[model samples]
Target: MSTTTDTAPITIHIPTPLRAYTDEQATATVEAATVGAALRALVDHYPELDANLYTDDGTLRSFVNIYRGDEDIRHLDGPDTALEAGDELSIVPSIAGG
Candidate 1:
């Protein structure tokens, strides 16, 4: 017998501070083949988050930290990290104060 499974969209958790840009949503689902595509789709859906998440050169902001599961994206392929169905991505922003 042969079996086939349908892939599900990836889930991204928006940080509390950035939730406002996502319609106050805590989580968003996007259909993408890679982390870069997922992030692009997210910003496309919520244009307000573009400036907060990425720079004018289309690179993620230095203060932003993206993780796939518990592994940091930076340790992976950065933005080009491969993604599978049901993967969860968390967007964390660095907080600074003295």
Candidate 2:
């Protein structure tokens, strides 16, 4: 695999519930040219998380959301959006009840 030496690595904060899928790490660094690539990098590193993030159509799961620096992904070309250094990507799982 090639390394990203020129661009700063982006950080993806792993929520408590998803920590187990990432070997208990609270945060992980992923190297990618774009947000979609970063997500692919994440799943590559943690195969178990693939099911939680993607649907059969290869779209992000409806119950899951990806935020880029407080911006919702759906409004920013979804995962294909590019990401810069210091940008935050969060994966939020929807809660159910009532």
Candidate 3:
């Protein structure tokens, strides 16, 4: 048996606070078949953020949220959702005690 998969290349906008973990780059481009895959690519590219972005259970952190353009993934399908080319994503870490 053989299987084939199609993946898209999308760009993720890294917020200011997370730039330090990404070598000061404001954005990064990754190729994957789904939102979850894209995030893993980001983690691979910036290993410093492994703990901050994901938990040991392979789930996104509670304080971290992902956006597909202006739409929140939590309301969509979490990370298992698929993304397309030219899609924009933002990693916004929830702030507290403001």
Worst 10 residues of 2 by lDDT: 1-10
lDDT string for model 3 (1-98, tens) is 22227677899999887899998999999988778889999999999888888789977888898999998999988887778878889998888885
- The digit string of per-residue lDDT tens for model 2 on 51-74 reads 878887788877888888888888
Cα error of candidate 1 at position 38, Å: 0.4
Scored by TM-score, the top model is: 3
Error (Å) of candidate 3 at residue 63 is 1.1
Candidates in descending TM-score order? 3, 1, 2
TM-score, model 2 to reference: 0.82
Cα shift from native, residue 69, model 2 (Å): 1.0
Clashing pairs in 3: none
- Model 1's number of clashes is 0
Candidate 3 residue-wise lDDT at 88: 86
Evaluate all candidate structures by whole-model CA lDDT and list the values in order: 0.87, 0.81, 0.87
Q: What is the overall TM-score of model 1 with all chains considered together?
A: 0.87
